[model samples]
Target: MKMIRNVAVGISGGVDSAVTALLLKNKGFNVTGVFMKNWDIRDETGNCTVEKDYEDARWICDKLKIPLIQLDFVKEYWNEVFSDLLEKYQTGYTPNPDILCNKNIKFNKFFDVARNRFQADAIATGHYANTSFGPYLENFKENTNVHLLQAYDSNKDQTFFLNQIPQQTLRRCMFPLGNYLKNHVKTIAKEASLHKIAQKKESMGICFVGKREFQDFISEYIDDKPGEYVDLDSGLSIGKHNGIHKLTIGQRCRIGGCENAYYVFSKDQKTNTIIAVDSGIHPALYTDFLITQDVHWISEEPHELRHSGVLSCDFRFQHRNPLITCNVYKISDNRLFIRLSVPLRAITKGQYAVLYSGEECLGGSIISYPGPSFFALNQQNSIIETRCCDLIALTSGVQM
Candidate 1:
């Protein structure tokens, strides 16, 4: 008798995950659905959607005649993901908690539980990315040398988010929806009589927080400190902002009664001020070089970067522009300095700089700083000089 492989699927209460469980079940695997509860926070109206999602997950599992497992990672999420996110915001960096969540919680903790506790031979998800054993593994029966590839649906490819996941974890993972498009996945769900979930709108914003306003959600943890908004060109105060932490690079200013809409060009955390520009197309908003720390590679560091000293990169996920050809310089084993082929707009610090060669994701790092455009630096220098003069004058008057 052929032994059935036990596969655990992460049912996220969405059409994609529901379809994934269905596909795996049809393939003769002993399928189990797992729902992860990572956030317990409620919105301003005291509403929480976790129960609704759990209901949906249970409904899907019941329809499929499979068992459902619910696990709470709330404490783990707060400590590992939320804490790091708050610290990054305090330091004026926009960090991606989704990336960290996949690394620390989903792949690490969830993977461990499914394998050890549930005795699952493999774990699966609804992510739109492909994974396969690496070449030269035909002779080996043991799972080894896994490669994460771009999904068949380029529009929904999630390799960027999964770049930080380790190769070993990826080897034991499955993506049932990898080869299918989003519309096709919905079609499968509808055919399987999951019409309610098929038509359910996709969730957006942060992963765990669901649909809350970003500014309001962040303010709950970090206090709001009001600051001045200065025009970079004129070095004059234009408007007042609620707080520098509340804003991000390249965000539009809601400051009313302006002839032209202003965009956040830069931020000075020390001064608690934001610099604005009248036009989004300002040269000051773009940068050609960025320095990053804590870089991670999925399989191994690129051979070209080590041998030839250059590799192409995608600084941001789902970026519409062409891939950036860059020269990679190693600052340390875990840090890198990348020079881009073209200047990118709003290269925010604390964002991941994911690298790729062809269709393979090479992994990425958190951006420490974006090398500012010459025009932006000049404006900042002028402001610093004026502030120094003002301080000196104040000290001289005290002496007199």
Candidate 2:
């Protein structure tokens, strides 16, 4: 197929993107390298890493012989992704920043600026996911009707992070590295006489605003206060906690003092209290239904099956959860009901409950709160204890 010549590829000063730009240039396309400065985060000790990132990106662009452009997006990052994350944490729920970052920065901000300012025909990246144009184009606007598919390298497939983008955006985006596995990418980088690029380590872990503990980084924007950690079974106060923002549901470490290992059950923001219980086997951990809001349906409405009475569905990224049947009791512009086939454990609030129908990902939203248990919330305590599983549900009542 003939290729679109003018392209802007996002370079994060990483091997993945470095290879992407080289591949595009190899195909005789006019490629301009763009280094996106999304956050001003430093290393763990609070030193700026921006210069290192810029230098690395510049080095790779020079080797690839492409014009390197820098786009500072710190303001957009705070407004679109990080600010919402802090609000969610303030309410005592875990927020996935990577998911939001992929949506707002890499795709939205990059495409918007690259196309409008640079007059580029297409924006490209090193994402290990596939994209293809749709069959029809009469009704399609620019970059519309695109399809996102799993990358050839399944282990590194990042389709989960790119789900929020609409079909059109995918159409204009390029993934030159989508067809190859990681090892092959390194091999190609080496064969291209870029051995050092091949030897570079991959970037991992949370994208922080500065070099600090996650709690400390978040604490700068959010307040910290003392709270109580109570036993799930006994309802007795076991210890004092620094703040509700410091912990997440289903986490097993750092709380200090418990007979058996305890997992976070619930956090009460109003009272400033945490409840945890022994990570015991309980059918209650497995829930049959989940409540959700802000539903973004990916395909045609789910067709309900008659044979199976249970309507369980996955509530995590990339079908990470088991295949469970779920019934959609109700759905509106923003709210909905999901009845699961079996009880599953640790249904967290504030996290997405992305439903699936076989290979296709149906759209989902933050679990605002868990539905009432078929049985009591807990057997050990007179009052119900919140577990990590209830994260999605409790996040519903959390104020935005």
Candidate 3:
């Protein structure tokens, strides 16, 4: 029934959160600024940007005349987010830390703190997505009917990064910046005399881990043993590598002494070998379907992507959210048989396979590929030789 009055807006010392706090304050909600100290403790070689971020958040809060609170979540960040990431990588799957951080920390931990600790009515953030809590809340004491909608600015939309969060958590969350474009937010910040935030560079990469080489950052937690780089087709050694963990699928750079253009398509931990394939001017790097595990459906009961025998999906986060039919039969209790309507290239593992229908994000899971991997089938390769689509369908089924 009634709209939320007291709100705790998570301020990250960035333009987006700054603008969100300003917008909420203007709307007459009792707003308090909180800077989440998720990764306060860093490794010996690593550093936490907490001091700088806290200072910036404090500065903005003073200017806006809102009470600022710093909540330290170092243990929770290590246990829930980073520890899970290390486990995923150890098992050879790529995991998006930001997604987990938002789900477990922002919506879950941060909301719990605001409700139980600070006694705030609701929690808000700078995420570029709108929220919808249905009118039938009187029937349910705890809200369980929230829907996440796309932001007005498609370019800055962060919905894909948030598909893993539970539906109920989406209820108590507010995204004030969702209705405005980045430029409009900048203008608002400037008019509000928050010009210091206007000139700040946008933060990139994982929030907990700063902008360093991924392998280098992870080495602190996980140790690696070096392996060999081999030609995928030939199985002949081309060069020695520091470790398989140092590389990833579809990577083309930093492997020593390749004759021509070569790309890493897969890695074999059993043989300690990195499979390198020939990637010409334009490599055939596409695929159809993905064997996925660890599914998280926000709204409805989880089901296989197939409804009428085809798996409908969105394989990547940015640009061209392709709508394709799919068929997902169960392979095990967890893993599923993902067969797409058409071929997709570079369907990377450890990447999110977010399924959608029109504007609704149904669910998402991790991407998986079979062994002895090669270039993904495409039209160009079909004219030269065997169609990738056919080869992929035939060979992938055999591997499965």
Candidate 4:
């Protein structure tokens, strides 16, 4: 064990963090709470969210009898995270803000601030994740390769959003909530006379969106670049769309004049077009392969991958999805081609493809594109347009 005495915890006014700070204090560690001010905008309630959250954070600190510090990173957040997010959305990429937030704000900036400014022996967060170094960083050594592991509570594991965090940062980080379930954390808070905190509604969706639809929130930044929704099989115009940024792959598109509900299959930036297919697990939505770029490795390249230039592992792009068998081939230093054991539905580009070996999160990268769709695979045997039109007609109850 590193014998960490002074620990700085990132408190977000949530039940998880409250329990985390409580656990650290009970363990006899010198604890300080840090309130990070990343976004300064007001919510739909006409009050800034951080303001309300900060008040709650203050309450937790007072109850725990720990000193609290406030750090502002509004500028750093804008330049490092939000600007890149906006750029990606405008460029037809469905970027995840949570991933970017962990990579830039929480891990990068917070790590530096806690270690350098506050002189924390170890930094802690309420994230539902674990590490090879254990909670107190007992197993960490000089240049030790730390593996980000899944939480005991699978439903609450946050490793997906944290895959992009730097290795050095993970080495010194502690997740007190990792070994416990979400409900248990709430119970702990309640037992500590924090009933109000335990029962508070969970913060949902993008933190900055603040009670607005994603479409409405994003529209304020990007100009309306008009586009059309085209039927991928029929090559017929389904309807006009105000902007491609309004939707992403697998979303049930709300375009009118189409009897059958449609879902996006692809967004063509150059043509300003959205390729779509009728809903109901449409064959066009499934793919057997994906191309990824800018891969990040937690413990450098794995032996199997580096020695043979390929490795077999489990892959999951979305956090909620279960892991699937896959073979990842190195295309270059930071690029990879992944072959899935089974065709999966809605493998979205711009989303991450996280690789795993059992419980350890190896790393991940942004998906560049996917291989031939199920619809494409069947094209050689049948007339794609006619079959697709028939399927649409059948689903929508239209006469064939």
The candidate that achieves the highest TM-score relative to the unseen native structure:
4
Poorest lDDT segment (10 consecutive residues) of candidate 4: 135-144
Better of 3 and 4 by TM-score: 4
On lDDT, the candidate that comes out on top is 4
- Tell me the deviation in Å of residue 135 in model 1: 15
**How do the candidates rank by TM-score, highest first?**
4, 1, 3, 2
Model 2 residue 114 CA deviation in Å: 1.0
Write one digit per residue (lDDT tens) for candidate 4, span 308-364: 988999999998999999999999998999999998888877899999999998989
In candidate 4, which residue ranges exceed 4 Å CA deviation?
380-400
Model 1: per-residue lDDT, tens digit, 9-103? 99989999999999999988899999999988877778778888999999999999999999999999999999999988877888888888999
Alpha-carbon shift of residue 37 in model 1 (angstroms) = 0.3
Better of 2 and 4 by lDDT: 4
Ranked by lDDT, the better of candidates 1 and 3 is: 1
lDDT of candidate 1? 0.83
TM-score of each: 0.89, 0.82, 0.83, 0.93
